[model samples]
Target: MPRWIDTWMPGSGPEAPGGGYPGERLGLPAQGVSAVAGFGRRLAALTVDWLLGYGIAALFLGADVGTSPFAVLGVWFLLTAVPVAVFGSSAGMTALGIRVASVGSEPVVGVPRAVLRTALIALLVPPLVRDSDGRGWHDRAARTVVVRTRP
Candidate 1:
């Protein structure tokens, strides 16, 4: 009801002019392939990836999440970094039909950038902080954006 309400209430208040979908600035579609990935999907993908990392840690690294957090985190780091560097998507992201792309002109998220992104992700705070475009701080720092692969 108050004019200040819009500042704090997400997705509420009177419609602000020029408000467009996320990824509009990147020249992506509004609802189809290449559109900015929604938080739900991105979260789901992260869940899947985390579970996978946990499993890998348990089986190969002999690490339990409760007893050996660093092992699980290390696994997650590799799981996120290598594939993203090579394919533009991690295993979970691929399964969920989303991929990380460049906000800049770069064609792919290279190893160094992917490692940096994963490192920030390991810190866990960066991903929780999203921008107006719905990109996490890690993505912004790496000049990458997550986009949908399917409509």
Candidate 2:
């Protein structure tokens, strides 16, 4: 009988060759800048973006973000999608030293992919469902990945 660890864990059996860390399969560096962004960094970037969205909605739309969910979401979507499309990262992502990039040969994620990714992220559940490599469903659907910009 095989050991439980061998049965459940990937790359654990003799036939399985461990590729490397989480994002290594995607050709990302194992550590330092350009590595996959971890959960804590991703969460921090999200928090920053949310706060910015709330602020924009409250100030420009003159809506109490606490009471106006749609306004905040709209602002959030704009903040996330537009910047990621053009710059590869939002203000929050930039501040947190992370960026979204295509999983393919391209270095930048185009507007369509950014929009789709943002939409799925807005649905909430998609972003919560992460693959073994830590890529959310939104990312997989868009063929994009978030990576650290600095060591």
Candidate 3:
């Protein structure tokens, strides 16, 4: 009945030999709202973005694509950087109800920042992040954060 009930268990006194539980102090909640529409939504968005990029690449490279890595980079650059500059959200993030914004600012990332972020993402492994806040390395690299938009 005390406002500050120290422990949940029946006999968890201050001097209890064993603590109540190992992680009882970490009162972190389930993060339901964020998680509710996370991986699935993000994955779907990435798929949409990839399709868009692939289409663009197809147009640029044509049927008989050459073997220049620069060309491939150029295509990917156009696919990602252009869209991020024009639209706050990439095709994938748009579909997934997320937008990229400056970490400490209300403004969206500019073309150069977007290019860096896109480059990291295109590198593939760098974008795969598993932080508690659900941000990828690319997000961190660009000083940007991805937020789930309300629609």
TM-score of each: 0.84, 0.85, 0.64
lDDT by residue (tens digit), candidate 2, 1-151:
7885553233343331463576866888888898999988888998999999999898976745688899899999999999999999999999999999899998689899999999998898887877656788788778888999998
Error of 1 at 129 (Å): 1.3
Could you tell me the TM-score of candidate 2? Answer: 0.85
What are the Cα lDDT values of the candidates? Answer: 0.83, 0.84, 0.60
* Maximum-lDDT candidate: 2
Runs in model 2 lying further than 4 Å from the true structure: 1-19
Top candidate, metric TM-score: 2
Tens digit per residue, CA lDDT, model 3, 24-103: 22221234322223556666777787766566766777864445556655665676687786676877777677767665
How much lDDT does candidate 2 score?
0.84
Per-residue error for 52 in candidate 3, Å, reads 1.5
lDDT of 1 by residue, 23-141 (tens): 67667888888989999999999899999989988896563456988888888889989999989999999999999998778888999989988898888888888766777778877
Task: Name model 1 segments beyond 4 Å from true.
Answer: 1-17, 61-65
Clashes (N, CA, C under 3 Å) per candidate = 0, 0, 1
RMSD of model 3, in Å? 11.5
The TM-score ranking, best first, is: 2, 1, 3
Scored against the true structure, residue 66 in model 1 reaches a CA lDDT of 67
